[model samples]
Target: MSKRIFITGIGVISAIGKNASETLSSIKTASSGVGEIQYLQTVHKGKFPLCEVKYDNTQLCELANIDPKTRITRTSLLGIIAAQEAWRSAGSPVLGDGRTGVFSGNTVGGMDKTEHFYADFMQDAQSGDIKTMLSHECAESTERIADSLGATGMVSTISTACSSAANTIMLGARMIKHGLLDRAIVGGVDALTKFTVNGFNVLQILDEEYSQPFDENRRGLNLGEGAGFIVLEAEGIAKEEHILAELVGYANSNDAFHQTASSPDGTGAFLAMKGALDVAQIEPSQIDYINVHGTGTPNNDLSEGFAMQRLFGENIPKFSSTKAFTGHTLGASGGVEAVLSVLALQNKIIYPNLRFKTPIAALGGKMIPETALLENQDLTYILSNSFGFGGNTSSLVFKAYK
Candidate 1:
């Protein structure tokens, strides 16, 4: 039998909150971090709403305990901050013993800094700071995070669009089960950049106001930036008292339906969710709650809703999308949502899908998401979905540690 994987520690820095405690507090009050653009220097500042981490690069460096003069990208800083928190939370395990690994997922990966470099270099070939381009690869942030934690084992980075972080977590669990490592620090991070913001704008999928996920009048997604990390250990390796939740099942699938849109029938989403359930050896009805990848886009919500209907039939469990709270964190969405899912299992609270109004009419208006916070209930099995562009979809089943 394969060893079970348990989540011992979690850390997140998003618009909703900087860490787990703050994130839980915001969930309790149904507060949303989606607001006016403040930190990102973008042309559509006043027009588009973004969920930023509410800190400048210098402040973030201070929080990450790194020297401000160090040439680092915002992505690396965010990853270091969250990864360190997760490491310390896991009792500061002795790393670099070749038994610990780091797996991170990200898409933009230092493009924020590269955008600045290219602009200046275009004007005067030697005008831009060459050092800014050092951390330009997706693996750079992952390497910096691994170095910060002193991990010398297998280190890898996944960049499968929005499903990146979920895949990383799945890979960590598989590695542990396969005896490749005893433990792993897994998550993802992405910093806001002009390139991403303008790219989404050109696609006409960015909502000017707060996103209304699962609602009939949903416009589109609001882009955001942040990082989230979790420490995973084999069942025998993690202390019982520190175990937060068990990663019971996980799976990844692709529909190849479109380059950026999910298939109307949600074939990829259904396959991913079903495969996870099969891995967990549980029925669809066993899922107590679902953290749907409701990106607030019409195509995404409709496709995801149909997928849930196909899997759960008429008895779909209570579900909601926290993206309305943090906006869509792009590559970090899975990691951020995974952290939230673990917290939900531990606390037995379901976060409300903020700003939800009407259900989709196509689903016969029956697919209403949990709009209000539900507290003090039995929540044993929870499923978190992360569907990304190019039809890449992933799901994770997290069960409360009995």
Candidate 2:
């Protein structure tokens, strides 16, 4: 039997604030969280803007309830922080009769601690702890998060560059709709490290200034680090409890155009958005808001703008990228931005697209600037898009819960 999917709870820890409440406040004020790196040690510490979490490793461990001596990866710590809030917010579901699962997405998994200790182990094979005790594999993050929540049904991680988490959420919804699981926890995490920093720098895509997605002056993306999670419950289970919203539609497609760059026409992106609309059974005109995967890279902005033009044209819904507020969190970016999308639908608040001065000449449309929280227009449905490297593209449709 086909099942309905609804989001019962959401939890987030971004550079803007510690939890969802603070992030909403920061968004309302149009303030920024991007600044010089403070917590993580990187050679580009002060050279580029970054969205770093406020808590140190110790503080995170305390909140996650992990032993101080246990060496959990930075990404795992982030997942734990977000999962705690999400499960708690979901009224901490009771699993006497229903099956529950967890799906997490991560790209740079456990690299922070691994890089920190790699040389130490290599240099002194006989001197100290091998430090291979931590789950350095990408799937390890998903396992740790699932075990933390006692989610014993199913668990996995997706690592399609940036679209990983969005795809994870999409999969969870499918599992429920297909009656595979009654409830699922879906999100992602990635920590800032020298590896990613230098990788982007080497690709010549790291923006020195605040990332301006869909802006003409967009230089590149500012790398960020954080985590976010959402509790997706079957409709029957969700109606049993009052919650935030619903998962209406989602889609994924690969352009297969280029490895690191999207097709000039954004074919894969357009397909994902169109597929989401199809799943929602919603016409493009019904969408109230759009949370774009605006990475601020010249190629992404142009390609995404072109896709938007093709999708919604002049009547495009209100949309913005939260990246300017919380630098690109890479693997965590999808889930982090998904939480932001649900916020807009639930609060009727449209976060300003920071740093947008002029619309791209390619799209030739007036960009939606930062707007104050408007009165809720009875928002019924929302479309959130996430695209990644390797031509991976995905979109989610979150509907307002009854």
Candidate 3:
């Protein structure tokens, strides 16, 4: 028997706020987390803006109640903190016995630490502590989180650039549907570092000001750092506890058209959305709101917009991009937006697409941006899109569990 997947609990920490409550409050108020750099010490201090988490490493340790003396990377620290919140919110259920697992997604696992170590190593090979580099691998944070949570079964990590977190949740649901596990903790985490900032700047896609997703005069994107997590359980387990929402459908597709940029037609995105709708056995008109993968970049917005036009025709659902509030969080964007999507589903609210001025002309005027926040609307299904580097595109369908 195929079991349905349900989100039982959620936890998040981002530049807007430290926990889920704070995140929701920020969304309701339409607060923008993008601003001047604070915690990260980088040479491009005044050149670029970012949505940095307020707490430094020491503060995060205090917040997570971990020993300050323990050496850990920021990525692991952020993931651990968010995962703990999710676990606690889910009643801190016993997770071992091969019935539960932890799946995490991240792009820069320990590059923040490795960059520091590399600098020291360049000065002197023996100057940097080799132990700090031990966590450099992409799987390191996932292992650390699973260890902290005492999850002994099927711990894994997904590193598919920006879509990593969404893929992790997809994998977790697949596991439960196949009866490989009864429950899973899934999400993604990324902390800002000089490596990503400089890399994106090289690409000339890092906007110095607040990103304006879907805006006609959109410049580029603002890089941000944060973690978002949700606890997924089978139908039976969720019925015994409190169920938040249902993960009715998910699908992923790759354009294979470009290494970094999406196809102008958004073929991958269209396929992913169509496949997800198929999985849920729903039609285009059934989706009440869409959390778009609007990165504010010229290529991304244009591509995603075109895809929406192709899929929904002239009667598209009301859609908005929350990245304007949280910044483009790279790997963590999907997970953070997933949490926001859940909030919209449960509360029957659609957040405004902040800073949007005009729609893309290529969409042929089929798009009507949701600028003002709307509440008290009866919502049945909401679709969330996440597209990443290497043309990896993913879409998830969330339904209100009435």
- Candidate achieving the largest lDDT: 1
Return the lDDT, model 2, position 293. 89
Q: Would you list the rank order by lDDT, best first? A: 1, 3, 2
Show pairs that collide, candidate 3.
none
Q: Tell me the whole-model lDDT of each prediction, alpha carbons only.
A: 0.93, 0.85, 0.89
Error of 3 at 398 (Å): 0.7
Q: What CA root-mean-square deviation does each model show from the true structure? A: 0.8, 1.7, 1.1
Worst 10 residues of 3 by lDDT: 359-368
Question: Whose TM-score is greatest here?
Answer: 1
Model 1 residue 358 CA deviation in Å: 0.4
Candidate 2 per-residue lDDT, tens place, 1-402, comes to 467788988889888987899999998888888888898887787898788887888888897889878878888989988877888888987643438888999897888877767768778866434565466789887888887887788788899999999989998999988888998999889888888889999999999988888887789998888898999998778855657888889999997999999999999999999999998888999988888888999999788878888999788887788889998898888899888877877786677888788777766656554544555457777788889989999999888765
Candidate 3 residue runs with Cα over 4 Å from true position: none
TM-score of 3: 0.98
- Candidate 1 worst ten-residue window by lDDT: 15-24
